[model samples]
Target: MQPHFAVPNLAVPTFAPASDAGLPLHIVTERTLEAWLSQQDAATAGWARTMGFSGAWGQVVVLPGPDGTASGALVGAGSPKSRQRQRFLLAAAAAKLPEGTYALASDLPADLSPEVECFGWLMAQYAFDRYAKNTGAKARLIAPEGVDAARVEVMAAGETFTRTLINTPAEDMGPEQLQQAVESLAEVHGATVTTVVGEDLLAQDFPLIHTVGRASDRAPRLIDMRWGSEGPTLTLVGKGVCFDTGGLNLKPGASMALMKKDMGGSANVLGLAHMIMATGLRLQLRVLIPAVENAVSGPAFRPGDILTSRKGLTVEINNTDAEGRLVLADALALAQEDTPDLLISMATLTGAARVAVGADIAPFFTDREGDAVTLASNAQDAADPVWRLPFHAPYEAMIEPGIADLDNAPSGGLAGAITAALFLRRFAGEARYMHFDVFGWCPSSLPARPKGGVGQGTRALFQALPDMLALS
Candidate 1:
């Protein structure tokens, strides 16, 4: 069965008219005066004071009416100029406020853009209650004036899709299921999809992909989807390792617990594709996912075995757990064949990236300084943070194990994320390549982000594409 989750649809009525909106939700900061409280009546102000509400960030207090029923609510907006607070200020309000339709009672700070607030509000309402029952009702917020409601809705929809795909268990989100999701997306957008599965992958020269996935009962496949035929060509490749048992190497129980999210890279790529298509960005878009499950069996590829890649480079499998980069190698080789104007690869490829940048910030690698600068700026603008890590060409020797042109994973374990990027870069050729080593998970809950599958750097790329590709 397909995974089930309810994502807020931005196309519908996202806001209520001020005339009929039930509650007046005030966003207060440390500087906010009690004078605004006077508008609520003496009893409401007294209740707020008794609750010790000093407008600290994310604090919420409800005002009780004379009848002991709810009259309104007050939420902390934090500092007017702090980027961190403004990023998801409304999200806190959306999550904590009682179930009802609420509207903004006070003018938001100039720095707290309406788009950010609207997007955060929509995201905060997300709930992944597929296996469990959610008895509580969700709070609703009216879209503020002058905000692009439709754009925010599309963004929220894309992020919700990403989270849903990543959160589903491995049994339900294997290679076949991933194909189904792609087919569903194609049907919605009038895009075309082609697949090379099982022996077909070998016949088509994707030997590494076949080698890694052949052991699984679920057949592995390469999903190729194409959308739009004009403007600059943009190719996106995501590692679709449905589950990583680490193959012959094997992972400890704790390490494998969340392997279901291994395909998080593919989920995020599809999410970005959704946003691009929804906005009708002027670009010829192609998405490549080497969907596989790195399972163990007699047929599973083992460490120290050398295999020929689609790009004709020999790779020695040093560690089966590093299968993400292996599958991506073949896909990136394919993407570079046409020499697209931009080639981007994203993967949950290395724990070193997590150790360095942590889970919240996505670390990207690229040789283009200008593109790196643009991406950083766009990431900030989108409120989706990304940091650039150097390609570090000197470490290329680490990937060369003498027996083959490349090593699946190098020894010594230093600059791991960089070395993996270097390995993939060999196959990328002359294409303007960008690789994102994303954690693809939120270990804990934040304002708009939940403690599950998340879309890291996806929004940053979405925001940067128009300018990067010179699209009008």
Candidate 2:
């Protein structure tokens, strides 16, 4: 089996001390290129022109010194209009720099904070070389002035862990492997992990989890991880459908192509757990992941089946493809058993989410107004963009079929994401819960962010937890 916990090498000298000797990295924008050239020496001006350094986004040009070593690097920040539309603008150029360490120049025209760029530069160092021989870029950046390097490293590691887990295909990332990952992470963080697998899930009152995963030989499970003995209790529930074959109602070839990423929710929460534990945050953190493979077999649950959830709510399975919410329903119910101060659930649960916000934005629903505001501000500052959707009470009717308490997949397919959020809301009860309907794959590459599995709302949630739970 492929290594389940192979995250980016955080110990690499990606961010050197501010006092370290390194070349200067100039953050340049298209509007400032000519002005910047005017203040340079004749040789430097000639070099810039010769290299066609127009300061377009992500363009990198190394400036060689008289001794033949790199004196500095010019990284394009693009135009203000372009800068406004993109995230990690500085990282675009930073990721392309040579292997040598470089420090940010004193005269940066862009309004971005040094902390954001530091995190982005570190994020660029990620390489998923599990199966391929592709040589990724090797660039080391010095921790910019006035930045807390430790905090940035924690954030980057969390994101790297999330990406690595999602990037691994189902062949090497089954339910067993997912549990191994949780155990590995727990060991590293000095936390405790417990798992109830197979028929034990039924014995443990997790009928929905067992029913959805009974068809597969790999066996299904509920993974629980806990850390931190002090402060507010925060429980995170992630839907861990290791591989969704759509059960009996199979998805099309194109749709099934990315089924390995069905466990993105599990990856995300695990990533978030890393950040919280590594930082030694003053909070009791609990994570619940329902690990399963929604594959077809003789015992697989089918559509039109009315099954009772851990919350005692009966769900009518209108589409087996919508199994994520079923597993999450049981996990959420279990999470509520502890009566956490804050509960958050992340899931790659619906195509309707991608359709609603496209792939770039993570759309979330929350029960608290103040938590929503805190998250919105933090997401903007963290460069992890998110959008909020109402847990529309009106749509509650759509999920209620006459035969059961709720419908897994509502008819008409209108407001699918909202209806799915509403469906999970039933199991959550009255907890201060937030649900993220994330599109875990990035369709295109952008700077430090690669074109494979991506993390959504983790950063925002990390930044918000301090305020949301009064963890300070």
Kindly report which residue stretches of model 2 are placed more than 4 angstroms away from their true locations once superposed.
1-13, 17-19
lDDT of 2 by residue, 1-472 (tens): 0112343332222466667788888878898889889999999989999999999877889999999988998888788777777777657776677777788786555467677777888877777778875444577777766788888887887888888889898999999998988888888778899999999998889999999999999999999999989999999999899999999998888989999999999999998888888888899999999999999999999998999998899999999999999999999999988889999999999888898899989999997889899999999888888999999998889999989999999989899999999999889888889999998988888877888998999988888889888877
RMSD of each: 3.1, 2.6
Query: Top model by TM-score, which number?
Result: 2
TM-score of 2: 0.96
Model 1 scores worst on lDDT over the 10 consecutive residues at 1-10
| Candidate 1 Cα misplacement greater than 4 A, ranges | 1-22, 38-40, 65-68, 80-87, 135-137
lDDT (Cα atoms) of all candidates against the true structure: 0.86, 0.86
lDDT of model 1 at position 229 = 89
